[model samples]
Structures are given as C-alpha cells and as structure tokens.
Target: MSEASSSLAYRLRSLRRLETFACLAAVIVLLLLPFVLPDFYVYFAALVLVTGLFATSLNLVLGYGGMYQFHHAVFYGAGAYAFALMLTKAHAPLWLACLCAPLVSAVLGFLIGAICVRLSKLYFGMLQLSLGSLVWAIVYRWYSFTGGDNGINEIPLPNAISSTTGAYYLTAVVVVVCLFLMYRIVNSPFGKIFQAIRDNPQRSEAIGVNIRLHQLKGEVIAAFFAGIAGVLYVVVEGTVVPDMLFWTVSLEVMVMCLLGGWYTFLGPLLGAAVIVGLRTFTGAYTEHWSLILGIILMALILWLPEGVLGLIVKPANSKMELSAETGRK
Candidate 1:
C-alpha cells in the first residue's frame, strides 16, 4: 500500500480501538445506572435510549440515504398506537403486540415510501409531512378508537417489565440490539449504494443501480426501528398521545440529528441524550426551556455544523465509507 493508505489504515485502527473502549465503558455505566440513581432518573435514562434509537433510525434515511423524512415521527406514533391498541383493544399477548407493532410501522413506511420516492428534495419532504399530518389528524380525532386528544393511558405492561428498573433494562437491550443491527446495515454494501445515491443519484442510476427500490428499502428499515423506539416509549411513558405523530416531534428528532452530527453514525444518539437532558433538567427549573434549546440549536448550526460528536469523530467524506463513519467501523 502507498504511504498515505498505510497512514489512513493506521488511523482507522486506532480510532476503532478508541471506539471499542468508549462503547464498553458506556455499556458498563448504563448497566449499573439503575442501581445507583433514583427511579426517576433511571426512567429518564431509558427515555434517552429510546429517543436516541428513534433519531438514529431517522439518520439512516436522512443522513445516509439522503431522503427528506420530515414527518418521520408518524412511524413512531404508528408503532406506539399499534402496540397499545394490540394490547388493549385486541387483547393480544405481549409478544404478539411487540412483534406486530413494528410491522405496522413498516407497512406504513412502504406505503408512504412508494409514493414519496417518486419525488425528491423539498417536494418529497412536504408530501411526507402532509401524509403524516393526515395520520396525526385521524389519530387525534378518533376518540372512540385512539382516545383522541386525551390519548390511551393506563397501558397494561407485563409485570416483569412494569417497574422502572425492569423497563430500563428492557429498553437498554432492545436499543442496543437495534443499534448494532443499524450499525451493521450502515457498513454493508447496501449502505454503500445508499451513500452513492445520496451523493449523486444520477450517476448511481447510470451505473445500473435501482435507486427508487433502495430508497424505499431505506424508508422501511428506518420506520421499523423508529417503531421499535415508539414501543419503548409506551413502555417507558405508559401513554400513547397524538403528539407522538405530530410534525413538531419529527422536527425535534431532526434537531437531535443535527445537534449530534448527522454525518456520524452515533451522532443522533448523543444528540438525543443532550436534548432529553436539557428538557428534563432545564424544564424542571423554568417554563422557558425551549428558549434555551433554541439557542443551543442555533449555536450548533452556526459553530458546530458537524455536530458535537463530529468534533471527536470526523465524518468520512468518501462515498465508499457510506458517507458517514461510526468511528467504530
């Protein structure tokens, strides 16, 4: 190999070592968090994990696939509602409810993606927002079914996972598995095509790749994981509200992505923690927490364009690295 290639390889290896160490440390800390912290903070950490997963799922399409998923949180809401309804209305078993919930989100994703992939850029995003708004409206008004604006509360959770610690552990496991799978997908050959299409759709098409099919696949995968996060939300919060599907929720997730670093694989996760932390801690002090959040986001956009994590882990500029680096891969 050339000297430059050798240097790059060495840098990658060192980065991988650092990432592995950090991950191990993080896992250890999370595992012990419940025992050390109060119940409320434990629940809060669980929220961070699920929210991080949601944002990461969005990053798969928005950051890597270069798709505009303006109303992505609809899939999240869909998953929550599906899980809740299955358990409450259908009287389904826990396993069945969990299994079917993400599928519902996936199907919704496929349907919306089928149409949205036909367009690009702002039009695609707007169409998704419109469709999402329609779903939100339905859920918001369906008092008989979805409990309308009041939402479905008193959700029955299994005894094993009903407690804060148990729920936190469950959320931790699910989130970790999902993150691993997503990380694998992002590094796979399929993810390479996603980046190629993102960086240059015309050239990718000219190279005999089916662009629309791949984009649709990306949508379904992202939605499926977002759905998983939603299920976790129901577990953590025990309520399925219309706000879950609202456009503003989607925007909040997008902000998490930008704040964490869309160009890095784990950036959204970090962003989610920061956002959730700010909301939980700052909101406790004053009602004007949004002003602080807005200022932080503005600062991130102007100064830390690559995101907070981006400072430590520089984004892979090459399309071959899937347009983003996990710093682990």
Candidate 2:
C-alpha cells in the first residue's frame, strides 16, 4: 500500500483506540456520579439521557438516512401516550408498557413510511409533518381519551421500583442499551445502505438497491427508538402532555442532531447533553433561558458547523500525503 494509505489506516486505528478509552471512562464516571451528586442532579442526568436518546433516534434518519423527517415527535409523543395510558388506564406493568410503547411507534412508522417512501426530499418531509400535526391535533383535542389540555397526571411509577435512585438507574441502563444498539446499527451493513441512500438514492437504485424499502426500514427503526425514548421521558417526568407531541419538540430533536454534527455517531448524544445542561444551568438563574440558548445555538452553527464531535474527529489530512507518495513512485 502507499504511504498515504498506511498513514490513514494508522490514524483510524488510533481514533478507534481513543474512542474505546473515552467510552470506558464515560461509563465509569456515570456510574460514580449518582453517589456524589444530589438526587436532583441524578434526575437531571436521567432527563439528559432520555432526551439524548430521543435526539439520537432522530439522527438515525436525518443524519444517516438523509431524510429530513419533521414528524419524529409524533412517534415520541405516541410512545409517551402509550406508556401513560398503559400504566394508568390499563394498570400494566412497567416492562410491558415500555415494550408496547416502541411497538405502537413502530406501527405508526411503518404506516407513515409506507406512504412517504415513494416521495423524495422535501415532499416526503412535508407529508410526514402533515401527518404528525394531524396526530398531535387529535391527541390535543381528544379530551375523553388523552385528557386533552390538562394531560394525564399522577402517573404511577413502576411498581417493581420505588425510589428515585432506582428509577435513575433504570433509565440509565435503558439509555445505554439503546445507544449501544444504535451504535451497532449505524456500523452495520444496513446502516451503510441507509447512508448510500442518503448520499444518492438514484445512484443506489441504479445499482439494483431497493431504495424505498431501505428507507422505510430506516424510518421504522428510528421511530422504534424514538418510541423507547418517549417511554423513558414520561417515566422520568412522571407525566404526559400534548405539548410533548408538538412540532416544536420535533424541531428541537432536529436541532440537537445538527448541533451534534449529523455525520458522527455520538454527535446527537453530545448535543443533547449540551442543550439539556445549558437549559438546567441557565434556567436556574434566568427566566430568559430561551434567548440564551438561541444565542449559543447561533454561535455553534456559525463557528463549529461540524458540531462538537466533528471538532474532535478531524478529517484525515491524507490528500497531500497521497500526492507526495504518487510523486515518489
């Protein structure tokens, strides 16, 4: 192999090592944080995890699949409503509620994806947005089933666990598992095809790939994960409301994906943490937290267009090396 190829391989190996160490260190720190931090902080961390998962799920489509889906909140809200209704109305177990949340969201995704897969780019996104808004309106106006504007309150925690600490641990475990699964999916052949579809659906289709089928699969996967996040969110908040299903929430998830650098696997997670951290810290001192967040987001967009992970994982400077090696040969 050429010197440039060798150097690139070496750099990739080093990056993989660094990532492994970072993951290990993060796990260690998270495990110890609950012991030293206050209960409120633990709860805050749980919220971050839940929100991060939700954002990352959206990234699965927006980042990898190159589909700007504006209806992600529909699945998230559906999961939240499913969990609440199951727990309160059906008196279901927490585990069962969690399982059903993603299933319902997957069903919704399948139906939506089936219809939207035929369209490309903006049209698909607009259609999903319209469908999502329709669902949100139904939930908001259906007073008999959804509890309407007041929402469903006093949602009981899982009977198997009583303490907030237990709840935090449960959420942390679930979030970690979900993230790991996402990581695997993104690194798999299926994920590669999704990226291919994102980069050029027409070219991929020309190469005998079933573009619509692949995109639909990705949509369903993303929705399933978002559903899981929704369940965790309601569990953490101990309540469910129509606002959680709004268009703004979908925008927020998209913002997190963009802020984190859509190309990087861990970008959405870091972005979510940053957003949640900023909100928690700023909200404590100022009522104008929204203004502050807007300014920060603007700065990030202008200065760090690639997101935080992009800053860390610099593109390999191999072009020059390749030219040098070719000259030597």
Any idea how many clashes model 2 has?
0
- Residue 137 alpha-carbon offset, candidate 2, angstroms: 0.6
How many clashes in each structure?
0, 0
CA deviation > 4 Å runs, candidate 1: 1-11, 315-329
TM-score of 1: 0.93
lDDT of 2 by residue, 1-329 (tens): 46666766776789789988998898888788889999999989988998999999999999999997987999998998998999889999877997998999999999999999889889999999998898899999999999998889989885534356776777788888899899999989999989998898889989989989998999999999999998888878888999988998888777788788888888898889988898889888899976887787789788988887867664543454664566566
TM-score of each: 0.93, 0.91
Q: List the residue pairs that clash in candidate 1.
A: none
Candidate 2 off by > 4 Å: 2-14, 159-162, 316-329
lDDT per residue for candidate 1 within 121-203, as digits (tens), equals 99999999999999999999999999999999988898778789989999999998999899999999999999999999999
How does model 1 fare in lDDT?
A: 0.93
For each candidate in the order shown, give its overall lDDT on alpha carbons. Answer: 0.93, 0.86
Q: After TM-score superposition, what is the CA distance of residue 165 in candidate 2 from its true location, in Å?
A: 1.4
